[model samples]
Target: MKQICAFLVIILLTSCEYFNVKKTSSEAILNEELETFNWNDVDEYPSFSSCDSVSSKQEKKQCFTDILTGHIFEYLQDEIIIVTQDINDTIDLKLQISNTGEITLLESDVDSLTVKEIPNINDLLVRSLDTLPKIFPAIKRGQQVTTEFKLPIIIGVD
Candidate 1:
């Protein structure tokens, strides 16, 4: 009877040790997984309303960029602003697309001469941005996230 009792105690102790090791390993794995997650890298790029039907990732990205460019050009093409001279320049626009697909114009960099030539150019750009449909924000590990974009617009006098 004493031998049997000793055997049972040894079995119980070994089982307990195994359980403890298992629990520690599981926790370590969870921590490692959390640490490996990257907050800066996005799983998917932001999407435009026009890109929703696309199936592939590259196609979606291209569609979004193309549609946005078209919209910006379309709005700018309609503006009647005149420069002091026939000027051609490029405007660098900084834009942020929020996690909820909201668009914000962060900044616009235009040549001093361009600004002087066409005062309402900034307003025109802002209006064009406002007219754009809501964008689908970028995806990071299945969560929607805000993203920044830099768009360059070409102004041609012809």
Candidate 2:
């Protein structure tokens, strides 16, 4: 019975979870957990000049992603215009953007996801772009801002 109880205690301490380190049955670690963590979940953490200042790399990355996503709508608008333009005046095109920043710009024939119109359209689709999203400035705590980003662009090539 004692052995089973000990095994149960060990199992309770550690569980397989993605992106997280499992804690062991250690007393010191429990004390750390008990201590209140001083974190401002709302105050987005921006880019830190030194890797040392950042609490965790994941926090930094999330800040970057939030900053990037905020401008995702903007970049999508630019991308549609650039790719639809007649580079050599050989293509016909009409492009438009939505308030949410979805895209619809195609040439003669489309072999993938696209829209016939922009207004009143409903659907959220992810596309890859030839150019990556440019990181925009983001507000962080204490008036500090950070810049980092990710954008996927989908180009249909015949």
Candidate 3:
């Protein structure tokens, strides 16, 4: 009888441990699933109004970039910028679009030569962006979300 009782106790202890392990693992799995659903799931990417006609995701993205590039280039193309250095320069801009369709200048990547040449370049860029029409914000599970974009501006002398 003592031996049988010992065996039952061992079984109970092992079963309890098994349940505990499973509970912890299940909790971890639940957290992981939530993170994936939140971060990795994007229903649709942000796009400019001009891209609305495009159906495919890739095409929409391309159209959005093309339209924005053309617009900014048009804005700065006429301006004559003089720099001390003869090296070719490019400006990298990071823009953020809010859920409410507002655009903000997050950061600008420019070299010393570009800044010295055109100190008000950032302001000009912002003004140019202000003229742009509102963009449709990104969507995730039917809700609009803010998005960021990096744009390259290459400067060439005429």
Candidate 4:
């Protein structure tokens, strides 16, 4: 009887652990989820009203780029630009789109030669952005998020 009681006690002690519930705080779970979440990518790209009906992610992105670059190109073409020397260069236009859908020029990577050839190039880019259609901000995890983009604008003039 003594040996049987000791065996039952050991079984009960070990089995108690199975019934115990481990409590996890909400904050801890949220922190863990955030740690594993990818920060570099967005669920949805910023879009124009024209791009709203696009179904695929890649297509949406392409539509956004096409519309944006087309507007800037058209704006630049509308302006009369003349250069002393034959100029051919690519300007990396860094732009930031706020969560509220406002666009701002963060920086323009213009080479000294390009600057010398076209002093108002930066102004032209800024003015072109000012003419952009109303933008819908990028979406990440169902929340509107600010995003930055580097757009390459080619400048060629004879």
lDDT, candidate 1, 33-122, per-residue tens: 989987656778898766878888888878888888889999988878666687688999899999988888899999888888888888
- Residue-level lDDT of model 2, residues 1-158, one tens digit each, is 99999999887777534448666777777678657544333244333243235576577655554444444345544443423322221222232222223233332222223333331112222342213243223343444333222233333322
The digit string of per-residue lDDT tens for model 3 on 86-152 reads 6467889898879887888899998887777788889888888888877888888789998888988
Lowest summed-lDDT stretch of 10 residues in model 4?
149-158
Sort by lDDT, best first: 4, 1, 3, 2
Off by over 4 Å in 1: 1-35
Give candidate 2 misplaced runs (Cα > 4 Å): 1-25, 28-35, 38-71, 79-125, 128-158
- Candidate 3 ranges beyond 4 A from true positions: 1-30, 38-41, 80-87
lDDT of 4 by residue, 59-132 (tens): 99999999998999999999999889998888898999999999999999998988998899999999999999
Best by lDDT: 4
TM-score, each model? Answer: 0.74, 0.22, 0.75, 0.90
- By TM-score, rank the candidates, best first: 4, 3, 1, 2
Pairs clashing within candidate 1: none
Kindly report which residue pairs in candidate 3 clash with one another: none
What overall lDDT, based on C-alpha atoms, would model 2 receive against the true structure? Answer: 0.39
Model 1 Cα shift for residue 36 (angstroms): 3.9
| Candidate 4: clashing pairs of residues | none
RMSD of each predicted structure? 5.1, 16.9, 3.9, 1.7
Model 2: ten consecutive residues of lowest lDDT? 85-94
Candidate 4 residues lying further than 4 Å off, grouped into runs, are none
All models: lDDT? 0.85, 0.39, 0.81, 0.94
